[model samples]
Target chain A: MERRVKLLGTGKYLPARVVTAAELDEQLGLATGWTEKKSGVRIRHYVTTETAAQMGAIAAKRAAEAAGVSLQELDCIVCASGTAQQEIPCTAALIQEELGLSRTGIPCFDINSTCLSFVTALDVMSCAMAAGVYKRVLIVSTEIASMGLNWKQKESCVLFGDGAAAVVVGQTPEGESSRIISSAMQTYSEGAHYSEIRGGGTMVHPRHYANGHEDDFAFDMDGRKIFRLTSQLITGFVDSLLAKASVSKKQLQAVIPHQASGMALRIMRTKLGFMEQQMVDIMADHGNVIAASIPMALHEAISQKRVARGDCLLLLGTSAGLSLGGIVLEY
Target chain B: MERRVKLLGTGKYLPARVVTAAELDEQLGLATGWTEKKSGVRIRHYVTTETAAQMGAIAAKRAAEAAGVSLQELDCIVCASGTAQQEIPCTAALIQEELGLSRTGIPCFDINSTCLSFVTALDVMSCAMAAGVYKRVLIVSTEIASMGLNWKQKESCVLFGDGAAAVVVGQTPEGESSRIISSAMQTYSEGAHYSEIRGGGTMVHPRHYANGHEDDFAFDMDGRKIFRLTSQLITGFVDSLLAKASVSKKQLQAVIPHQASGMALRIMRTKLGFMEQQMVDIMADHGNVIAASIPMALHEAISQKRVARGDCLLLLGTSAGLSLGGIVLEY
Candidate 1:
């Protein structure tokens, strides 16, 4: 019998401090109801810069404990992060060392496709498990978007928050039928410039920093274009995934799209004809956590009993690099 | 029958200018023969600020073409680079857009375990192929250590180079003899501090650049510690791989170890009891290209007829993150 990769456990972590829309308005001079009417983000978590990696490590530990496995049992460590501690050695390696699993012969690495990173990591780990290359894989998606925020740029600053989420994936008997059914991914490089943190790459040397390009260092976005592209891609990809899994639109128990923007989610639901109740949106409280959004939403839905065993959950994610991916998981 | 992952093609690109030990003496006043006698490096390639990413992209394109596939045929892009174009969207995504293949649903990401990245990437892609999740995958390892140099730090500045190499991996017919057999990987994060670019990461946010800490930006090394670790890990891992493959050390046709130092290789060979001629040491010309070294050496060996059909090639790689991986490929 062919082995199937199953999602065993999920967990999420958000920094302690929460900033309400009113407080944000007072701080940044935004219009009243701007956060609510535009992105439905009434409040969001903000890390003190010292807690991003710690939060991610905590999330992974929770997932592992919930999975009933010790750190030594993990065969691979895959972390997807938009905000990393360094540009080398990979954050996964550091996390592994922090967890004291560095001596276990587990190969650790990072995967980045922007907000799609976590789901993309799941796809990669699933393939590894199905191929018998790994038995247990720990995937962590952490984002410290607050670090990229320019307080003066209210448009971009209010949309992002800091958080991390993790899930443990392993193989189970095929008869269990609780596994990933199908996944579809798409990328449009032309749209990469639509949203980006332009500074601190090879193109711009670290030492060549000048203050004039402060906007380039902080998060920048063409919000209008992002909304349109995100809605169209998410709707199309989710539909493709549903069709490939041979499941009707109504059969999906819940849709977990990235908590990017509330308006984007509304447009996607309407375009795909998904019921309002059938969709799970956590951006109202968490803001856009970048790669951590989808997994954070999934964890919330599962814990709230919004989804149950044998139910089909549709996950969609998109971000800078204009990368998009969708997956159907039966749990 | 289980399917196999095959190496469809190999390609490499090295920067034009070569810096010799004599030239190093003129540039940094380093003693003659110290580099050669200790690290066995006579010359190394140095990339001008303009050539790093372009060289990597060219190698990737050549590999794709040699595999008889256009960029559109690729489903995934994994670039293993110690030096990347930027910290966001990944260097792989940039390469995808540059190659004009970003619209093909190909998810691009980067994997870094220092010099072990290429083999780790190969191992990751193998699982993806065996699981039938992707029909084609491109893996590239590129490094521009020259850019990470402190010209005043003669210990490191004289022992590095810039280059890139790529390979196309995909499904092969069952029972095919030419394929990757098995791989063993191990990471020792306890030594993670042995070699690293100390200042760039979140730990030392560049904005807090205080005076008198210039050493943090340059690559730092405890050469004695690395020498001891590399010799032991390479011999032990390669032996384990050979035992698993049921092949004897004498049957190995060629050995490709990360070109960190010539003295390290000599110690590894003596300790492992392997013939000197069977080992490929390109460090004399390329220094330590980090992740790019193994594939660059493989490309040269294949082109020079040193590796051919039915030959057993053992590749051993080790570096920062203190990661080590070995793979036995039949060509």
Candidate 2:
């Protein structure tokens, strides 16, 4: 009953338009350097003409190329995203269409756990792939957080960017040591309301807009509460995850976190006892791209050769569900 | 690699407000009997004060009771639905809160394949359960499609209602014969645009609301195109699915199909060769509740004793991806 799953390759895509903190300062009527100091985001990408599916397809292609597999060879496509391209068809279908595999008879669907989508999908899909339910599966995490950002909430608004990342996975070959060691997810819904967009779904239908519920449509977050709730639970959660994996923090070659913020990364290095050099920090550049954060950082880690084959890697993230998700795997 | 998964229990929920086609005809100012003739719906439920999560929680509680498992014992809760309760946090977490399990630390997430969501999640989760990734899981398909219906689109508007269904699954006990035989999903995105809600996501942000894109937020479907495309592909899809399971059409004890429409159900019997008595038909009562359709029908079939233990059951549906998904299982 040994479970085996390998991370074949990873790829990421960022929108072409870059919005700098300095420019945001002018747009939001803030003083120079205030936006950067407050949000710790120097620059972040925002989509202009590109879309969530288009970015995802580019990343998927790169991942397939990196894995030495063709998109046509994929057995299934799972879109693990915080945001959707449209409401009905599921983002994965749009991505399949974008990849020109619409008629390939490949299965397409979506998994959502808000910002932790990629980590959760990787965990679940690994189980499926290892069980021989599928082979050569593609998972894409795409986000356009900027689209839902509420400029009024400068704290949360400046902390988000638009990006997409994708990973190709399959069962390990006979000689490869790559495999998922352990994964865990816990939802603390008591804090679910701490970060959310109240509209765009059934509860507060769009038709209510004529009745003056526009604010419900915008993304809102009480950042301090999320930080407080995450701080209280993450240590125990990570400890339990590592315990299940029978791996120690010292054994991990790298830590790929959700790129939540500069402050959170610093807390990981200092408060959580992880070495600064072991962490993948992209918040300053990419900001928080919601679900794309973890995989995008993983892609960066792999490309930079910071994480090598057979090395233990820790993937962790706290999402809008007030959920903590972590995966320990041999890369 | 033998896979065994058992559906321990099934439950469904509908709002107390039942609107008959007569009522709809009066509301829309249509001729008497005209609404029923076009939509093939006698009555359907619409949420008044209830939310998707509340309905799902009630169904989940019932499913747990039927399964003889406590909500606290579940390893995970997966919401498989086409509609969302909110834009973030995921509908599963919301259901967790509604069930008073917010602090239970069980993992919660969502799987969306539009109308085929329940079928897809059952297929995927069965593999996970059989693989021992999770011991017990709850999957709820809760949708409030009525909230998004565009009244102007009379053809599509009268064909949807609000409801929820849940199933509890685990690895079959040693003496039990229940297990998933085979499953398949194929997305033809060439027909993706035939049914969709173009707004409320990253593609068409709510900020565009002021500029007048209200129609984008409402559900839209070309029913004739969907029927035409489905007619061309569904026969082969079911044939391949049954073939993979090594089960013949005649061997299936019950056909639990998504109650897409009364006409679709008729076509399922007349063209797809499933006997009338073998098919579970609840479209007259529930209309098309999107992702909840298949599981809700399954609950009805199970509760009515129409499908006995160890019976061969075929679950089938066509979704917004223009995706055809089917599962053949020993119930």
TM-score of 2: 0.98
- After superposition, candidate 2 runs with Cα above 4 Å error: none
lDDT of 2 by residue, A123-220 (tens): 88877776677888999999999888888988888889999999999889998888888888999899889999999888887667557888788888
In angstroms, how far off is A57's CA in candidate 1?
1.7
Q: Model 1: runs farther than 4 Å from truth?
A: A1-3, A49-51, A173-175, A211-213, B1-3, B49-52, B210-214
Docking verdict class for candidate 2: medium
Question: Model 1, residue A271: displacement in angstroms?
Answer: 1.6
Each candidate's interface RMSD: 2.9, 1.5
Error of 1 at A91 (Å): 0.6
Q: Can you list each candidate's DockQ?
A: 0.50, 0.72
Residues B1-331, candidate 2, lDDT per residue (tens digit)? 2368889988999999999999999999999998788878899999999999999999999999999999999999999999999899899999999999988889999999999999888888777776667889999999998888899988888999999999999889999889888888999888889899998888987667556898898888998899998898999999888888889999999998888878888997888898899999998889999999999999999999998998999999999987999888998
